[model samples]
Target: MSHYYDEHDLSRFGDMGRNAPDLWDKFNDWYQATFQEGSLTGREKALIALGVAHALQCPYCIDAWSQECLEKGSNLDQMTEAVHIAAAIRGGAALVHGVQMRKRNAQLSM
Candidate 1:
């Protein structure tokens, strides 16, 4: 019983497999270079990652980024605030879809 519902057989983040050394090397080169702390401080990066984790609905990333954010001196207040922002954005996004539903209902009701 795999926890993940992907064709890749691995029970994790889409199984960009490291078993293939050459592909792993290339992908790791890009991902590592891209997803690094970059210009942001560690705390800032963790906050952003937490928001993205929430938006993407990745529990593993949420857990990891929350820990990272805490370790990087993000207090509970800050972390929860970040989550609230995520919630607002996600909720707003869903609510915006009601426009489509409303338009469709109006048309179908005609």
Candidate 2:
């Protein structure tokens, strides 16, 4: 069966640079700079990236950040917790949109 998200496609990510070299270079530089050790340690950043990867629902990012988390000394427990955090935020964000629905319903009822 053919799947939409091929794991092998992750390897071809660099090919994006071929089409837009300048833009890709800028993005690469920014991405590299964002991951550098600073106020937050590399491990902390990796955990955050993993959480965001889950939130964004990007399989490639999820896979990459999972490995990044592990390599940065994050344990399964930590990674799982990060995923849960992302889940909670995503769920809450969706639930909060109910306010808009409620307003629309009220307008229609009037």
How many residue pairs clash in all the candidates, one count each?
A: 0, 0
Please give each candidate's TM-score: 0.73, 0.92
Predictions in order: lDDT: 0.80, 0.97
- lDDT score for candidate 2 against the true structure: 0.97
Writing each residue's lDDT as its tens digit, candidate 1 over 8-108 gives: 44245435565677887788789667657779876887898898899898777777788889889999889888888999999999999999999999999
Predicted candidate 2 versus true structure: per-residue lDDT over 1-110, tens digit per residue: 48889999999999999989999999999999999999999999999999999999999999999999999999999999999999999999999999999999999996
RMSD of model 2 against the true structure: 1.6
Best by TM-score: 2
By summed lDDT, the worst window of 10 consecutive residues in model 2 runs over 1-10
Q: Which clashing pairs does model 1 show?
A: none
Model 1 score (lDDT) = 0.80
